[model samples]
Target: MGLLPLFTSMLLFSWTTLNAALKITKVDLSIEPSAAVYRDTNVALRCKAEVLTFGTEALNRVYTIYKGDSVIYNKTTSSSEDLLYHLPQARVSNNGKYKCKISIMGEEKASEAATLTVEGMSTPILRFNKANITEGESVTATCLALGETGSLLFSFYDNSKEVENARVTSNELTFVPKGVGNHIIHCSYLVFVMPNSFKSQTSNTVTLTVEELSIEPVLKISPQDNVYEGDTVNITCSVSNVTKDYQAGELLLSQDTELLKSGKTSIHVNWTAHARTPMLTIKCRLYLRDVVKVVNKTISVSELFSVPTLKISALEVFQEDEISLTCRIAAKGIKKKSKVLTIHPKVPVSTPKIWVSGSAILGRKVEIFCLSDTGTPPITYTLWKANKQNQIAIVHEFNKAANFTIVINEPGRLNHYLCKASNGNRTPEQSDKLQTAVIEPMTEAYLMVVPDVDDISEGHTVILICSFLGTPPVTVRWLRDSDDLNPLKTTTTNINTTSYEFVVNKEHTDNYYCQAENRANSVESNKINLVVGMAMWKKLLIPGTIILVVSSLVMVGFILFTRSRRGKRERAAELSVKPASPKSDDSLTVTLTHDTEVYNAATDAASFCDDKEGRVTNGTRGSVASLPADISNRSSYSIPATV
Candidate 1:
């Protein structure tokens, strides 16, 4: 058993020693090489050995071993410290598998393998799942191995081919795509091994698709084209593959201001938006599309024009001169330049030219001469006018003195005058207007009379009044209220000086007036009414006619006298029928009594009858008082009795 333990111990020692002896102690190279070598160039190789002193203090010491007369390197020779080998040139031949032996100072130590492999370059595999990748987006790339241990260095490159860091790792690498282009991306690396001591592992060349910012977003708008002055404009920014979050920068409109976006790619641009009330242009600007910074566009509108300033000047003027008038307007905008223009006429005047003169008159030949001038050109103006019957005197031809009468006709009405002016080619500028009254008397006629009123009495005399107005000496006739009175109505024209007498009677009480009517215009004098009132009695009837009244009165008196005479004769007859009794003389007995007595002619007549006839008793004169009559018997019928 003890032997077994001892033998096991020896065996363990041997195994441990062999294992330690075989261990790779040091792997190193002399004459360091640059990381990159151009194609087809000479490159040198150097190697040193130092694995021989693993268990001792001489662990860092290095040397070489000799083999035959060829002077080859070994563990013991100092030449092994720096063994140099110069290759002919860099080529396929230059590509390599290089080797070196490692040893400690005394014992032949561990031997290991390394490589110097010329990577016959081929471009890496360039591939991208997407051609475009937006910024801030996550992505990954896989480098497929062309050969060897299958590990590589990861690198990033900008569109300019600028190299980024080379980081070594196994399998795929992750990154955020930073820019846009045909991105050429591949990886390079080294392998740990022999003659071809190191192996460069390359990936298949690939293109990484990275997204870039757009130039200007295809500006999407709700109202595609025109927005009114007062309206709002809305624009939306979008990158086909990007979310609104990335486009959430600003939309610059018209360069005036900037606006921030939220989750929305669109924003409302508010404005008062007044466009063409007077015709104008408007613009809008938008920001942050791609590498490009801004954008712009325009809009338009139209407005209205109003009536301008106007009025009149002077009232009246003399003949053979100019009439002063003016027209005015409110000044507006940038004061305008002059233009060519023409004028319209007043009261139907033909070719009424404008002149500088300010005043014009009525009848004497007037002049209106035009002259060229500068300044705000006045609107054209017609000749001054007033009233329907043109009172302005006229001239057919402008005198050589430029004296032209504008008023060929007359007007009898009030009028409005204007100066219609323009800058030969543009809208006009008018001045304050002038008004003038036109009056003429030469072309007219009227009525006149010499003795307007003459000769008259209270229902008796004659009076005549006369007057006239006319172009020429016109004759006049005296008319009583539009009527031609008969010759019997007036005296013969024996009087001179157009004076005539008129008889005033009760019949002429109405209008004893005279009208002296002439051809031109007529005139009449006021009426003369006559009052006829004369003496109360004598004047009423002719004196001779009153004599006839007296004659008729005399006739009536004679008839009454004759009637009284005839009546007296009849009475006398009656009285004679009785005879007087006796003529009692001297002293007739008289008796006065209370009751007076009446004399009885009957008794006397009875006595007279008795005496004539012899009286008998029975016949008693048909009664003695009855009486007989000698006159009665003559047959005058019977007289009425009153006695």
Candidate 2:
């Protein structure tokens, strides 16, 4: 191929433009495998000249090859055609500029220069995405070229041996480890150069360590202590070992045998505790294939709140009284704590009850009380007196108590009275009216004798009368001087009067009075005196003297009758001696004379004591006799007879 430049000039041109006498033709140059070539490879080059020339032809032609102006080959040929140059086993030193030249007899022509290139070797690197992992875990290995290459195929190797079916279209390879150990890994790539294929150098080795998988389950609950009833609790169960081989329902959370939530490696659940009865057991379970791990916790909730009870002290309460009250809660199996409080209850006003308890005498104080019932504190009491016109007037008032007192300064002040009470809440209450005249005992009384005169005779009965003026009926009592008399002798004749009937004597000559009394007051009547004289025996002596004078007159009359009878007899005898003369012969025997006396006596002894008069008469002698009236004794004279 080095003589191709002289053969191309002999086949076509016989002319040269530089020397006009000797003409040369134009030529061109080219090389096969025009792209860059690999080290220790082959390459070829060609040169041609124009076919026609318009100049004198040359008998002899020469061809030569040059490298950057230094000739390497020279040949002489008599034919005219194209020339060829061949470079076998090309190296980095053969890479440079090349050209071919032609000479006809003494004229020469040159072709254009052509260039050649040769590439050097490149290194490959091996790397992995993970250094250590558990068995059943996946890993990726990558191989990269430092220089540019086309149409590459990557293959992985383990332990200096090619892995079966471990080819990949990309520079990376992914696989799962079946066993646990430290394994060396690398990759190699094949590149197709122009006309053939070449394999690159093996990449740097890397080691992967695989171990057994182990993890523990953990349980956590929010608000670990002092939990109350009816509160929501959050429970979380988790595990640290997570991989692509993890299946659903690996971790579970439950409360008291009831499942709440399930997840892969971790789970969460919310539970509401029961009211006042919270004793729950929480459990967390982790299932790794056939192996199981579990954890548990217990929670206890406290009780609820209650209202307090109140208790007060003191048996009875009064107005403006201070008291204490204590409050506490009665909880079972709990400590007791008490709180104290102070209170003051109010007192209300009511009707006033009044009582008069003093004498009705002038210049005396009377007490009245107004009653207070259940009400507020600080009661007011007012006392009122009613006059003759039935009008009331305030006499005494008490601010803090329900009592009042008043002085009776005059006798006319004994009238009606009233009492009122109040506590400033509403209208005041009043008691019923009470009259002093009706409640007071009888007063201003007087004692009257039946004759209303003082002097009286002794050994005789006299009448003593008592009378008084008061509102209520009064009981009268009789007294001798200042002492009380015997009630048997002094008897009550009426509601307000008593009579004392007894034989008057020297002991009854003292002053006597009558007393009148009632519930309110007592009074005494005016004193009365009686006088008795000594004329009792003189009245008896006068009746005795009259009865003696009447008895003496009867005795003297009998004496005078006797004397007259005797004188009559003497006259009769003298007449008898002289009667015998004349007309007396036949009747002389019947002419006799006699004297008769008459006496009258009283019937009762009282008339027998009176003075009497006596008469004497003699019918036979015609003579009358009279008795002396002053006869003192009837037994001192007897009847005198005449014979």
Candidate 3:
């Protein structure tokens, strides 16, 4: 029982303690929450602490929670720290140190303590994502943080005066200040501890940046002065630049309480803003990193971009022409801004589209274009031509310059030419007619006559030869002297060729002429002169007359001999015929010869007797009446006697 026994016991105890300590290091004391609940309402609290090592006796730890001289909770646990605990209820009377103690080797070690002030209701942490309140109307602000479960006195104070108050049981508290001023808030615990009651602490001081109720923030956009549809703009929307844009929205940039644009080389905004505005007002506040209200600025969004002006230009152009055209367009706009140019949907400009007339002759061209003042790729152009026939747009050029040369072909054709250009949305520029002209071609008509006279007989024909030159086929109106020949004898020329033989005659002796005519009612070369030499007049008649005279002489001699014998026979025959005196009527009969000449004559029969009816009476050698004979009589006169 003396020294030896005591030493053995001490050794055993020491070994036990060492074993426990080693095991404790391996013990996982993992906390469940990511952060601490620094404040609380009611304080009926309980926590768990247990030994997990099997080599050691399983034991529970005791816990104590406190706040400002007040004990909030005290409890003993038999389960692991992972275990959950439930108290009958939270009470304002329960508040204090939040700590846990465990027994080991007969020594006490405590867990970290958490103070719980059972104020039941504390002045809420009037916290706002934003610190400064901009000028304008009173604002309702929410204050939030981990707190006790009992009712919380949500309050706002101006220094020491109460500005607002609310009852809250949730983790959050809200308060609204009536005006601008410095404010302080204090929360006193409602719970009492063995040695002391709950203490109160004042909250962080706050100064409301209040100025006035903000009129509904006016809104505006940059370049609002004038704008084109489908154009890109550096757009913004804001209550004020200092209050919202680069200052507030751009990484909390502010001076004192005044909101200012961030100095970042690049601009970034939590939200868009309109910097270009007229009379459009908004509230702005100067600020400090810790949220101090300085000044609120009212600013307007400025017009950063202007409506684009489209300029369309052309050097030359003419009307009534058909040819290619070129047009030029120009425009200006903000950088990094996009703009579109819609050419005159139609190829030509909308205005008197300065263009070459479809009927224009060659040597001239026209141009048309559209331009933008502000925007990317702000110019557009087109070229086109109308034909001489006045047919529209037979050709066109796009996005190019405008210029055209029209080749006129039609006569007296009027060309109404025009051009247009445009920025996708802006009005287009127009050009005037630069030139005008007309064109016509040459035309002609005539008749070709080829005539041949192959026959030239006494009663037959004479060849008449002739021909002509000109356009189209022409009719030959054959003419003999002043007489118009029948078409049957005339020939229609074949294109440029013609030929025909007309009967030759003395009638053709004079000038022979042929006139040609065309569908245009046009006349050609006057009657061509033709000399028709008459062969009939030169050959048969004159020579044949001589032969006729000789024959007649021989015929007269033979007739005399036969006449002597015929007289005796004629007398005997007459006696047998009951010889009667020659009747004067019979002797008065006229005999006609087959000649081109005719004659009528009467001679007195003095020796003839007449009856009462004017009939001639029989008488020896009675006188007779006869037709006048040819002046060149060819016979010898003789008289016959009657019995």
On TM-score, the candidate that comes out on top is: 2
Model 3: per-residue Cα lDDT over 287-312, one tens digit each: 32233332233434345555344433
lDDT per residue as tens, model 1, 1-643: 6999999999999767755664434655442363235444456556655343234333333433221122234333433345555543343323433455554423443223333334453334544555556644555665443433322344544443535442545535566544565566665444432223333445556666656554343344445355543455554444334455554554433322433242223444444444323333232333343333334334442211233333333332223435554443434231222232233222212223344343333333434442213222222332333312222222332221122245424443223433333223434333233344433222322222222323322445544443333222333344454355542232222211145555555455344443332322434454544344443354556876888899999999999987866664454344433324532232222111122233344454445545754332431212112233232222222222222
Clashes of each: 110, 26, 105
TM-score against native, each model? 0.22, 0.28, 0.20
Cα lDDT of model 2 by residue, 1-643, tens digit: 5589888876555334424554566877777776368865667767666534444554455778887777877878766766777777655445567788887656677888877665654557988899998756678888896553456778888777787667776888888654568878888887654345567677788898987656778899997677765567888999866666655438888877789998877787777664334577888998764456789998886654444556778744556667777676754444334444445564556666666555454455666555555445456666776622222233222333454666666555444677766666568777777555324345578888864444466777777787776544566677776456563243333365656666676666767787776655667888887665444665676777778777787778888887766665454334422222333122222122123222222232113223322211232222112223322122232232111
Kindly give the stretch of ten consecutive residues in candidate 2 with the minimal lDDT sum: 615-624
* lDDT at 356, model 3: 36
lDDT preference between candidates 2 and 3, better one: 2
Task: Identify the runs in model 3 with alpha carbons over 4 angstroms from their true place.
Answer: 1-466, 473-476, 479-494, 518-549, 561-643
Better of 1 and 2 by lDDT: 2
How high is the lDDT of residue 96 in model 3? 44
